[model samples]
Target: MKKSLRTRLYACLWCLGMFVFLMPEHTNAQGAAPSEHLVFSFPADAVLKMHKVKIVQSAYTEYFEMNSFTSGYAGLQQTPDSSKGSSHTLISSLWDPNTSAGIYSSVAYQASNTYTGRFGGEGDGYQSINPYNWVMNTWYNQVIRAWKSNGQLYVATFMNNLSTNQWFHTVTLAMPAPSNFLGSGNDAFLENWDSNVKWNGAFVRKAFFKDCWNLNTSGVWQKHTSRYFSANAGDSARNGIYDRAFDAGYDSTEDAYYMVHGGSTTPGAGFGTGRTLTLPAQTNQGTAPVITAGVISSVTASYASGITTVNWTNDNTTSPQLSAKVEILDAGGTVLYTQQDTLPQKRSTTFMATLSAGSYTARVTVRDIFNNLSAAVTGSFTVSGRGTDTTFYKFKNAYSNLYLGVKDSSTANSATISQYAGSNSYNLQWYASTQSNGSIVLINRRSGKALDLPGSAQTAGTHPIQYTVTNGTNQQWNLVVATGSTFLIQSNMSNHYVLDDSASSTLQGTGIILYAASGTSGSANQQWYQESVSSGLSSLSGAAVSAALMPAPPVTASVLQVFPNPAVNVVNITCKKMNAKMWIWFYDVPGRVVKRVAVTGSPMQVDISSLLPGTYFVKYGNETVTFVKE
Candidate 1:
């Protein structure tokens, strides 16, 4: 039907006005808020990669992009919809290498509760999304492994929740031929994808990225030491407004680089659109999941079963252990057996061997998933085929004629071992148990403790103490026959260390310590005489023995004297009780002999000019007197 020209013109004008009203007022009216990027440059030879990110601040409709390679990007996002229950998610996407050539990326393995589909808003690609309730102020580790599989390049994504010490595999994607590997350029960014201008730039978003590393073709981890910070252009062609609330720089407190945008953030000095920051060089290849050393609690050897079991524990609270290396060595420091334990959380291992009687040491070390090894710990044991001895006997120092007894008769572990006068108390009596390795464990009859070398100390002048019987090699001693009925008690851990009366002192409470063994005959202080207990004395009870013990006598007076106490060239020594020829010995403070002379008469003169200027002790008979040489 025909209509009036004015009516038609009015309708057309109304349609044109509506079209003009719907059009965008500016070119970037629908563009998102300012987006900041942290571009990282890696080594040219890198193949595998690892990175970390910690979101210090976040807002809805924000994406904290973590690892962005040449092919695609992976990051954490806070979705705009909170009522849908999937407020936070993890995303990984890869662009089609050659869309025009028909080459595309396809999903090889998709994890459960994850979505895989096509995305095309920014670029033609495939992406995987999984609901991840990531919290703020927590660190997350991401690792990407790339390899060629079946003539196609495959990349697998793994994420670690550092707070929970749990690892999750998101997905694996494969690209068609011609895409042989991941690109060398790695980057990250903080993005505001919200188009709502009023709220997009109103909230704050910040994150910290650090410990970036790439595994090169040679399998060595190389850390990225330089990075550049840049932001999207804010001109009319890009986003309509320049964002002054954006900053990116190194944070010394976190030992990482930080990026912040939105909510009145003022860029610090020298932080412009494109600025390169040089970071300190790292000494370690990568972070070690576990750092504590493995501890060995107890080690035992069974002669009947020919088995040695070692018990240990590890601080695997953060990372699971990969394996344990166990080594067993004989007394001669020769390695006898080695084993590897691969089972996680396995705390015990056994070594079976037809071992001859002798002392052996066991050493164990642990390794974590990151190939970090812990310090080694050691233990010792002995295997004996003979029966244990039950008879008790007293051990007397051949030089001092004093009996070895537990100090104060205390039954506690680490009780001091000292020499005391003879007594019927059981603390002075010990029974020797035979081991397959020809070593003996000396068990104190009263305390039921064995003489032990505490902590397996390898230093000289370490005092021997009594501890609960554990059959440890430190508690076992070898009885080497010396002159007459005296024997040298050598520690099973090392033959060079032997029991000795400290300083050859005759004091009632002089300590018994381990010292270097002298010659085959041994020094007088290193020699001991084992006296069998009489049947009558062995039948006494604790109360009876305590009552029969006598108080120690006062120290005897010296019968020797020295004149010219501070002598320069000569000194005179007189012995009031001297009757016949006797040997006089001069000893230094360390119990080492300095000079010796035969005194045929009293008031004998001796030259001292050769001696160093210090205090010296002269011994005659059983008496000792000090004199000064100037």
Candidate 2:
């Protein structure tokens, strides 16, 4: 905050204390105050750090989604504050360079200088500029939230010198000290002094404290203190002088960040015994820099046909787990689907997949070795989609799951769900088969189930060759296979999806969907674990051979009951075909409906659990029902 240059004798000497002062040390609810840590620093070595972003809204997010797409606007451009337009904005896969990090009225704040007339913001940070900002970046436009906690993530950033143009609000949190702040010995000293200072003439009054210093691996800012003339004539500037070799290197291999705003721009600035004045010192602000602590263990999910499989595990010791990744958020915290799994090394795990059914949350994040990260270990899932009973359960949530598409059946809303980021039309192999009481199934082809959903599972007519529901998943169906471990391609969750209806894969006819896994070694999709393989037998995806019993059956007519059957925000579907074309599904419990909708009609007597509740299994074709939406 050195920002000198008022020139006209400091512009009438300070226009309204530089347009209102700002003091932000925000916190939203919950308990345990202050502990943000990172206090004091000077030459010893100078390195400071911090980064966090906790706002994960999963359970199928949607609050004003214009068809969301953000890694911060994905370069469609605009944002210089929008002259008056576009902004579905939720961007930041880290990388902004200069403009649009927040406040956007359309750019204003002009720039009377003093570093854009005092931070151009709530205390300044330049307003907008980007050469992509610095290029070669893999991740550094500053979007750090670093994850982990239970598997390891113990970061302690140190890079502070606030006090120059004044805005040291308060970063007071302490716990480790002994020459680490700026001097660079690395015992990890972080205490929190008036927010480690980042000022602007002390909040516009123009200089009771100017502020400037950078040592989290330097890009520039040094200066410390300065006294320029009379408090009416006391002439005090604090003396200034504590500049280590700078950015205190512990080695910075592409953190993607680097800056040193104005030694006035640099030119000879005295190594100073008395001389000193290379000028520079103007710097902006950087918060929550990066800090995480750890301790979780275990969480899993998977699905076939509708695709979805998740994993997690971490043990913790200052960012110990080392490698772990899994994400699928949609309630609004964004990030829908991200997988990089590996297990067997020392156990600790995390992996996710195809994902459909509904209720999905497998955050699990880990990273160690100084890059620090660990503070995420969530688990929730619904996935279901095996093969038959008509097929149409395609549910996509968990932070928009990148926009998968197709949810139009009678419009219960989710805006008809169609989003994509990692797309190839999705679903390579999705699944969710559970029956230990939990329940879940949602098939897929497009949308609209034929019956199955708390409305009750019972069907007839289409029972010509297969269909039969005394309730063995009404007649299961689901598929896709690949296995190994460290995540080569998981999705056999005990495997079962064999459809043929005589379209045969051979052995025993073949019209399968089963439910209860752990069966293998057979191949042709585990041939139903053969051995005569009876039990509501159908086998060949059938068209004829077996399926008969449908004379008086068909009586459930179900529509929706999706309750706290394991839910998260609101999922209660009941159907009678409101407007027209319908199929409100969410299956698993053998049946299969990984989450479908195809909506078109309307009057089924509405009530769609805000998109997600839990424990589901609602079909439309051969009928199926099971509820719980709480």
Candidate 3:
């Protein structure tokens, strides 16, 4: 085969592809060379089952180069080596409006045997750590059938190496495990996969890739339960977790985890803000979403120092598996850490972990109590130095059912690439990475002053503040992100924590409070400030007041609230704490919601812009929450 033909084969392979590379040279006992036939599983999972996904826009994150240096893309539909040891280490992550963040996956390379060294050319050329054993022979193909395995689905890749006039079949990774997982006494809110059935599916709904696996996997890739994928999406990417959040619930779907990410240039105005930079759940091309895990249920490792904690959150209603097993993997792929303790049915959990110092990857293999195992959800990170590790989560102040937060100052404000937030759905915010004097750090929504910890210094869990603009009377504040749906605002101030009211986490109408150490001990005196607004700066809060006014602050103008105070649907604002000048406006979470009345000053009744009933939050002096529709 000619060298040019090989390069073309690699390039065109993104779409349809075919191959005729030399047989690999793996040595056998007799010292004879191993034929490609012996090294690869022909007509195996490697055939491209779908069409090549193209560069919609220039994908900025071009770190690895398998596909020649083009713009917006790389290859995904290509098949993996069916043979046991054949694999490729594919590194990918988001390269958009935000900076590039990298992630890696090991794949089976069908081209050669025991490939070593590294390969670098245009774009981010694929390379080997050792530097001379592996070689990625590029090929030529334009239209190829891209396939996704998810392992079980047995996705296949078929490329028509237009240059060589040959067709090749390759298999991708395995199907993702079911939504649930298994655990032992360690895990707080996951499944116990050890004794459950394993659930795996291709979840391949992208139309570009046809059902080529039908002829291969036999019966592994089942149509995603619903119409292809009628199932709602499950959020995966999240950052910033803590150990003692029992006082408050942790939600990755809320503003905290999703919006706290960096910016992206994904084309259009939509910077892949709050969500991970990977492709959407059901997009047409390139590498598809993947989660892999071996059957091994439990593994353990230790955290040298700092804080050791874990957070688990995923809506498994649609993809229900049973339990989940979390294992920590060492550099050699050995199970160094395992947390398969008692598991919770639903919701996310963040608890303690043994501290250690080293590079570690977490592998979560979920299963149903019945013994069904879901594919593995794997993530990796390294631990170095240590300091105060306080994380904040954003919660739905209006509905009160949702909880979420984003990475904050403690994380070095490195402006690391976080995931994008959902539409109109509240997510966390904050994008300032610099600390220079006029830096764009988070500022108080009311005071206009830059927000910082109380003592003129800063701590990990410090609540931002600035008592000037509006909530000044109640020390109100709000969290903001450059992109995403709704944002959370610390609109009210609490006089008590409500603990003295009933010593219970319930009985919420009392009032919102500050993050003061002394007050938060379940005391009503440690109340918070909150609110819901119709639009603009038009907001209100009916939160925290002096404990002396507990049980119910006299119906004084000082303690009344009509939340989702600022009405979106039929003006649904329930009054509890009491009130002040309830200047209301109806604005979209994007600071775009309209108001029924003017909201410039806090004089009186404002308009809701008569906009259709949607999600809106009401803000009292310090409390802010969501409102509903008719």
Candidate 4:
């Protein structure tokens, strides 16, 4: 088998030509650790089935080694051509600070740099400037299109920084190879190379690959969900460097595209072979139904005895026949009634149930033909037989347990109203009567005065008062039945707010005010329970009471005449309407109460001159009269 010298020389030249054609401008340096690669592979005949390939890899890293750089690529490859050498093209997006600068686009013959062995030197590789500073720790999308045209192989590469939504066109390359002559298969791979011949130690890097697709020559895209293999440097079938890094399917709602591999650098471990990963089996499901609109609108409930009739409306006019499932829940969220029914959808539909007196909420849900459920709609109501059926009653704040009371049982033009803990006070009783205009007027039995808003201020926090009945809009109120036993006392003057104690205070004498009404009935300040009492205030008269609810005229100011002015020890307070609980607060010039004495009855005696006093103000009930004592 010996050959002539000329033949041997020719053979050597042919081998050199093949090496140049198949070789990458890549060379491993001493002390540099081998780069690990995560490769997503397809069928061995993937080159024939695929016309284009794409991958999106989001890097969760920023730092790169000083002397070496790492890159991830999406490309088409087939088995190496042993006779004419390897023929494969790869598009690489590199994060090299020195060569590529930032995330830049480049084309490669294999994994590193483009080469032309048959034609002789390095091939045109890098193209397009890295437009963005290429944000660190972000994902970038890369694509490769490959197809045979008129007896020639061509590849066009494109890249986009997904984080920035910017794209750049890389160089397109051509070769005279056919699809059958392509190397291995389409793959996504990461490579680390030492450009300076020294191991500066590579930093750990990781990326996520998702939303991969394959386009056939007919221009149809199909999902590329396939199994892949993993390997280390020692495997004989290795195509790239291998490390301890790995990849698996993202397998979640946010990202369903089985992710590719990522890893930390393993110095001294050279690049090994590429491996394919395997995917779990799954069955396909059809498209889901469209979303439906929830329809329940207003809810009105009325209770008499123990029976409560609940009525609600659905406003979906476009679909009047829409069906919905309804559930009535008690105050504790326990389901009391559940029904699946077709909604009238226009007028109000009624649902009646007999239950103990308490608050309850209605839950409505609609479903489309495909069983897709809509968002839930809800409303609240109450059922109570205690005092709502009566015409006259006392109202108690559910949160403070305080009764609404008129100041000093006043029948004045304007008298303060407050919440107090006095349960036996007749001044707390009110007559509820519907006026001719359909508004309710609450007349205090003790004062014969109506509940009013001073100055007719409809603003929140305005303290309510007792005023002479004029049937003005400011004196009208509405009783809105809420959760069982409790109701919302809403003023017709301020339709947006309800009667409430300021700051939900439980302290006695806290002024009863108004607050913005909320959708939920859980707030204590808005809930009031009624206590059945006398039915009419016609039997009560302001003159029959000793205390003039109205301010005493100055001519009759002698009604509370104080005797023994400049008294040495005892001062007598003569008032016809005095009671034991009624007291006089003696205040000094500084307005501080210096002494508080109980008035057991008319002509009560108070001991003074116990301390210094120049001028004093005596407060009896709501009236503050001035006197001096030595």
Best by TM-score: 1
Per-residue lDDT of model 4, residues 433-492, tens digit only: 444333567878777789998888888788888988766788878665443235678888
Per residue, candidate 3 scores C-alpha lDDT tens digits across 1-630 of: 112322322322222212322222212211110000000011322222222111111111111222211111223321233222422222111111111222112221222222211122211222211111111233322222122322211111223332344433232211222221110000000100010011101011011211111112331222111111011112111101110001111123321101111112111223222211221222221233122221332333324332333334443222222345666575668774454522223212122222235677767766532234666766666766542122212233322322122222223322211122222222232211111111123322212233333333222233333322221322223333111123333222332111111122343332222333332122222222122322212132223222432323323222222322223333323223334423333443333334433223322333354554333444443444443332
TM-score of 1: 0.42
Q: In lDDT terms, which candidate is top?
A: 1
Which is superior by lDDT, 1 or 4?
1
Candidate 2 structure quality by residue, lDDT tens digits, 471-539:
234323332211110001112222322221122222221222222222331222322210001222222
Predicted candidate 1 versus true structure: per-residue lDDT over 188-238, tens digit per residue:
777765446654666788998887777665656666755677765532233
Every candidate's lDDT: 0.65, 0.26, 0.26, 0.46
Clash count for candidate 2 is: 198
Candidate 3 root-mean-square deviation in Å: 27.0
Per-model TM against the reference: 0.42, 0.24, 0.19, 0.26
Where is model 2 more than 4 Å wrong at Cα? 1-293, 296-477, 480-498, 503-567, 570-591, 594-630
Query: Residue 615: error of model 3 in Å?
Result: 34
Alpha-carbon deviation at 234 in model 1, angstroms: 4.6
TM-score of 3: 0.19
lDDT of 1 at 173: 66
Where model 3 places Cα greater than 4 Å from the true spot, the runs are 1-6, 9-124, 127-294, 297-630
